[model samples]
Target: MTTYRDAGVDIDRANEFVEYIKEKVKGSFSQELVTEFGGFASGIEVKGYREPVIFSSTDGVGTKLKVAQELGVHDTVGIDLVAMNVNDVLTTGADPLFFLDYIAVGKIELETLKKVINGIIEGCKMGEVFLAGGETAEMPGFYPEGVYDLAGFCVGICEKGDVITGKEISPGDILVGIRSSGFHSNGFSLIRKVLKDSGVKLTDKIEEFGKSVGEVLLTPTRIYTREVKRLKSQVKVKGLAHITGGGIPENLIRVLPRDVRAVVEKERIPENPVFPWIQQLGGVEEREMFRTFNMGVGMIAVVSEADKERALEILGKDSFLCGYIEKGERSVKVI
Candidate 1:
């Protein structure tokens, strides 16, 4: 007879991992939360607001985790997980209320797991959301050794009428782009292909960026919570775009209203060293580059041209006027 552990699922180790995260999750508790840890489902009191709508998002770190595993770095990817999910919720103009995570691995490393939880805790703090509860599963045969996968879910609340979808976006709305530090957790498969074909390793430091290839690749995804939440109440934000996998053309246009096309000057996007380095090394084409990476601008804000200055002032240093909306097909033009 085959037992669960014999079948490659170690229940004991999974339990230990769950216990390991208990205190960390509990530390992020808020007064609105009802339950913490060891529950089949997390519970929270949905109170406040005249009329409230709950917005939720679920996302993962994607293939970026491969670099972390190869480089023996287990932290920060948790932030990427949180950013991916929370930022998506922010697109709906909701305040993130709580988050849950799912971590699966072939084997359990206490130290690495601790570091991972630490990163998640840090991410929760950054987003100002409670860490509700999560699951950790050890499947020895399912994943390769020292390899893990991370996924997270975030729930946010917004007043019923205050949620900002792109429905209100109109022609002539100015597009404000917030700069990204590097490749914010998308298109790592292309990155890995480029690096592998070019015989590049994580240990090799690219002179242009002055950091190891892995270091640049593993930079945590940025949290736009502070910027979006701050500006939402004070400005007429017609739409918000979280630049991820499909880059600007695909991601930005998703939130654009019909009959509104955005004209983005290519020169307006800040070019960073790693992008060109990868392009020159891998012989990747310009169009593929824009489709694959953030190319410096991360999150975008579509607001009436009248409120442009106030939006920039509210977003502060990292924000800039990247482009403007025009009357055309619902498309993004990179001039």
Candidate 2:
């Protein structure tokens, strides 16, 4: 007789994986999370606002996952998974509430899977959000035994009146750039192609990076929620931009009003060593570099010229005056 396990789906093993996930991620549960584990869905009670609007964002780790698989490092990408979604919700001045993840693989490896779960728990704790629930699917023929795909979903809360839609961004507003932790989960397709053709091994160390290429590449994306909360409380922020797959030119322009453009002074932003090392190694064009990677500016906040000093003071050492808004159709200039 054939069973579900015979059809490339292991019912018993999948059950075990779920219980393991429950025990591992309980640390991220909060008083606000009202649902128990092993449920069809999760719940969070809305509170702390007289008028609340919900914000939801979902994202994957992109090709950066290839680096993690190559390096046999599963944990950091879990953090990157949460960072990508929460930071996007944060751009709207929302308070991240809870997170869920989806993992798909050809077969389940308990040891490898646990590391990824622990990493997700760490990410939820770092953002002060709850691990509501998640799904792990094992399809024997769909993927190879060791390969897996990860994606995350996040929901955030904000007052309806407080949503920042970039409608307020005006000429002369200052663009304050928050420093990136590294290459915060982007441009890895190009990075991989370059690394592969250049005969560079993941274990090979680039002297300036002070770590193996794999370690540097596997560096998890930064979570900006903590920094953003403080900035919003002190400054009358007109707009916020989370620099993601599109780099500064594409992501920054999303928050600009129809009648304004952003002028970013590239030199004003601090540099990360990984970018230049790859540039020379890949022989990639200057314009393409800005179009792909964060180039070290992770998030950009638009504040009035009057509040520029105060905003910079609030952001402290990690921030820089990158540029200003000018009167024009929506666009971005990275000079």
Candidate 3:
């Protein structure tokens, strides 16, 4: 007689894993999280909004996970997973309320799962969102041993009138860019290819980055929730873009009105050592590099020229006046 355990899915181990992670998960809870673990559905209180709008986003860390796996580091990927989703909802001018995660692994590894959970908890704390619930699935045949995938779902709320849809964006809006920690979890398909083709090992130390290749590559995606919230409160933000996969041109256009185009001054962007290192190693073109990576700027905000100084004051020294909006076809130009 064949059993589920014989097929490599151990029911007892799954139960034990859930029990182990319960407290760590609870560490992220805010007062809004009403339901606890072992529930069919999690519950959160809808409060504070006279007319509330719900904003949600789901995303994964993409191929960056393969690097983490290669380095035997599983903790920071969880933070990257949460940052991807929370930052998306933040673009809508929402306050992140809760987060849920999905983890699928070939087999349950208690210590590894614990590290991931701790990372998620840290991300939730950084974003000030609740760790409401999540799922952990062990499917032996679906994934190879010692391998897993992570995805996250984030929910946020804003007053209906407060949504930053970019409809208000027009010509003369100054674009301010916030610096990124590093790559922020996109374009790794090309990154891995470049590394492999160049024969750079994960353990290889590069003096420019002041860290090993794996350390730089596995840098966690920055969480922009707090910065964005504070900026919105102080400035009249007409548009917001979270730079990701398609980089500046692709992401900034998402928030521009039809009559306006974004003019980003590439020279104005602050330099980061890792990007130049990647460019040298891969021989990637400037255009391709901007299109593939954040290139130092992680988030961009459109504000009226009159409000630029105040916005910068709120964003502090790391932010830069990257460019402005102009009358034209709906597109972005990196000059």
lDDT of 1 by residue, 95-170 (tens): 9988989998888777888888888888888887888888888878789878899999999999988988899888
Q: Write the per-residue lDDT of candidate 2 for residues 1-335, one digit (tens) a residue.
A: 99877887887788888888777766556544665566798767776798999999999999998889877899999999999999999999899998999999998887888889888988988877888889998888888878999999999999998898899999989999999988889999999999899999999988876799999888888898888899999889999999988899999999988989899998898988889889999999989999999999999999999999999888889999999999988899988
TM-score of each: 0.95, 0.97, 0.98
Which runs in model 3 stand beyond 4 Å of their true positions?
none
- Best of the two (1, 3) by TM-score: 3
Error of 2 at 161 (Å): 1.1
* Model 3: per-residue Cα lDDT over 290-335, one tens digit each: 8999999999999999999999999999899999999999999999
Question: lDDT for each of the candidates?
Answer: 0.87, 0.89, 0.90
Specify the poorest-scoring 10-residue window by lDDT in model 3: 27-36
Cα RMSD of all models vs. native, in order, equals 1.6, 1.2, 1.1
Best by lDDT: 3
How do these models rank on lDDT, best leading? Answer: 3, 2, 1
